[model samples]
Target: MSEQKFTVGSSITESYRFLADHMPHFFRLIYGPLILWVMVMVGEQILLIEHDIHINSVYFLNVITAAFAIVWYRQFLLGSDYASYRLLIKKGFSNSPLSFKRVSRALLRILVVSLVLLVPTLLLSFSMMVYFHGQGVPLSEAFIQELAFKSTLIIMLVFSPILIRLSLYAAGFALGRTSLRMQDIWKRTRGYTVTLWWVTLRAFLPLSIYSYILTLFLDVMSEKLSINYIVSTIIIETLAGFLTFMILAIVVAANAEAFRILIGVRDGDVPHRDGLKKNTAMPPQTNRRQTSKDIPQKTR
Candidate 1:
C-alpha cells in the first residue's frame, strides 16, 4: 500500500482522530501514572498546608510530576500498553524515553543555542544597568524593566523556530531512533517548521483559553464559598493538574503524529489506508466458533 501523503492540517486532524478512537485505551494506559502523580501532588499540598511552606515547594513537585508524565506519555505513544508504577517511577528518574546520552547531547545543544541567543541580550542588559547606575538611575525603574521584557520577548521570537524544530526530539527519543542528532532532526523538519507551529498552536491555544476561564471560575467559587482556603487550593490544584495532563497528552500525540509522518517520508514508507498502524504486528485471531456464530447459516 502506498503511504497516504498527509498535509499538516490533515496530519493534525488524523492525530486527534487517532486519539479519539483509542481514547479508552489511552486513558487505561495513563491512569496508573496519572493516579500516582495526583497522589503525590495532593500529598505535597497537604504537607504544604501543614508546614505553611512557600508555594515554591509545589513547583518542585510539579516539575517531578511533569517529567514522569512525559515519560508515561512517551511510552504510550511508542505502543507500550502496560507500564508498572515501579517502572514508571524508575523511568521518570532515568528519563527512559530519552537516553542519558541523547539528553546530554540535547542539553548541550540547548545550552549552546541559549547562550548564542541570550548572551547578547544579557550583555545589553548588563551594559544598560551599568550605564543607568552610573547615571544615578535605579535598575528598578519601570522603563528598564519594560526594556528587559521587550528584549526577552524579541529573543524568544527569534529562537522560536529553532526551538520548535528541536521539539520533536522527545518523540524521536521515544521512538528509540538511533540517529536523533540535532542536525538530523533539523534536516528532517525542514519545510515543516511552520506546519508544526500551526499544529501546536491549534492544539494548545484553546486549551489555554479554557484553562484561564476555568481558573477564573474557580477563583470566583472560592471567593463566594464558605469553604476553607486549603480546600479551595486543593480543588484548584487538582483541576489544574488534570488540565495540564490533558495538554501534555495532546502535545505528545500531535508530536508523535508529526514524527510518524516525517519518518514515513524519510523512509519512503507507504502510508497505508490503515491510518498509522498502531500495531506493526498481526492481531490475534478470533475464535473460529465465535466467528461462525456471527454468520447466519444458509438453510437449503
Candidate 2:
C-alpha cells in the first residue's frame, strides 16, 4: 500500500447516488426487514411507556437489516448485470443471495466492532454509577448523569477514528475479504487515520444534532404546543423510521464506496455468476477512482 487518501465529499456523493439508483429495489426488498425493525422500535417504546420495561430489540434487529443492506451494496458495486437483472426478475428484487454467508459473517464482525465502540461509554457509565453510589448519590442523580453523558460523548469522539478503521470489516466482508488481519487493515488504511476520523464525524455529526433537536422538539410539542402524545409519537416514529432506513442504507453504501476509494478491490473480488468482476484496484493514494466524476455503476 502506498500513501493513502480519503474523501469525505465524493464518497458521500457517490453513496447518495448509489442509493438513488437503487431506490426502487430498496423499497421492494428492504421494506420487509425495515418494517420489522420499525415495529420492534415502536414495540420497545410501548413497553417502556406501559410497563417501565426496556429492550435492546432495535439494536439486534439492526444487525438483520444491516446484513441485507451490505449485501445490496456489495451487489450493486461488485455483481454482474446478468446475475442482477436475472434475479431481479425471479426473486422480487434482490440479486445477492449468493452472498448470504458472507453477509452473515460480515455483520457479525460489524456487530462486534460496533459493540466495542460502546465499551468506553459503558465502562464510564458503570464506573460513574459505582462512584456515585459510594458518594451516597442515587444512580439517577442528575449531576452524575450529566457528567457521565458528557464524558461518554467525549470518549466516543476520541475513539471515532478507531471506529472508522474497524468499519472496514464491513466492506471487506461484503467483498468476501473476511480474514483481514489488523496489520493488513492498518497497512491498507495507511495515512488515512485523520481523514477517516473526519469523514465519520462529518457524515454523522449532523445526525447527532438532528436527534438532539428532535428530542427537544418532541418535548416542546407535548408541553408548549399542546400536541397529543399519540400524534407526537406518530410524527416522531415516522421520521425515525425514515432515519433508520436512510442511515442504514447510506452506511453500507459509504462503507463500500470508502473501501473502494481508499483500500480498493482486487481483480477477483466477489465474482458474479455471469463471470463479472470488479477489476479496478485503487492505489492507496486514491488518484484514480475516488476523484473521478463518474464511476460506472453497471458492468458491460
Candidate 3:
C-alpha cells in the first residue's frame, strides 16, 4: 500500500464518515464498558449524596474503563467489528492488556517531552522567585503570585504545540506497537501540527458543548418534575457517560485516521497479513476457452 497524505479538513471528514458508518458496531463494542462506567459513576454520585463521602475507588474504575476504551480504539484501527461481550473482555485482557504498564509508559513519554519543553520556564520562574526574596519581597505577595500565575499561563501557551504534537501516542500505542517513541511521533507529525490542532478543536468543542447543554436540560426537566435528586443525577450521569464515550470514540477515530494517513494506509485498506481483504485492481477477463470460430475474422 502506498502512503497517503491528508489535510486537516479531510481527516476530520473521514473521521466523521467512519463514525457514521460504524456507529452501531462501535456502540456495541463499547456498550458493556459504558454501562460499567455509568454504574461506577452513579455509585459514586450516590455515595456523595447519601453518605457525603467521596469514593476515590471510582478513579480506579475509570482507569479500567479507559483501558477498555483504548482497546476498542485499537480494534477499530485494526478493522475489526464488534465481538461478543465475552470476547471483547477476553481481548481487553489478553490481546491488549490496558494495564498500568502500557498507560504509564505512554504517560511517562508525554511527561518527559512536556518537562523538557518546560525547563526554561521553570528555571526562569525559580530565578525570579529567588531574586524577589533576596530583595525583601515575600513570594506570597499578591503581585509576585499574579506574576507566577500569568507566567504559568504563558508557558502553557508556548508549549501547547509540542503537547499537541505528541497527542498521537495513544493512537500509536493502540496500534499494538511494542513501544512508543516521542521522536517517531514527532517525525510523523512533521508538517501537520497546526492541522492536528485544528482537527482536535473541530472534533472536541462541539461535542463538549452539546454534552453540557444536554445535561443541563435534563437537570432542569428533572427539577421541574420534582424527581428525587439521586434519581435525576443517575439519569444525567448515564446520558453523560454515553456522550462521553461517543466523544472518546470520535477523537480516537480521528487520531487513528490521521495516524493511518501518516503511515500511508488508505481508507478501507487493511493489511494482507491480517487476513483481511485488500483493495486491488481486478485483472481483465479473457475468454481463454473460445474456439477459433468464435473470433471475428477480417475479409481478405
List, residue by residue over 1-300, the lDDT tens digit for candidate 2: 213355888667666766675566666556666666656666777898878998888577766565566556566456534223335324322334545665576468667876776777778877877787898976656776697787778787787666677677556654555456666777777788877766655655666578668866776777677776556665676566556566666766666667776666776443321121222344546644454433334455
Q: TM per model?
A: 0.68, 0.64, 0.67
Write down the TM-score for model 1.
0.68
Predicted candidate 1 versus true structure: per-residue lDDT over 195-233, tens digit per residue: 888888887777778987997899798989876766776
Task: For candidate 3, write residues 211-266 as lDDT tens digits.
Answer: 99999999899999999877887799788878877777777667767777674343
Provide C-alpha RMSD values for all models, in order.
Answer: 7.8, 7.8, 10.7
lDDT of each: 0.61, 0.62, 0.65
lDDT order of candidates, top first: 3, 2, 1
Candidate 2 achieves a global lDDT of 0.62
Clash count for each candidate, listed in order shown: 3, 0, 1
In model 3, how large is the Cα lDDT of residue 227? 95
* Candidate 3 Cα deviation (angstroms), residue 2: 5.3
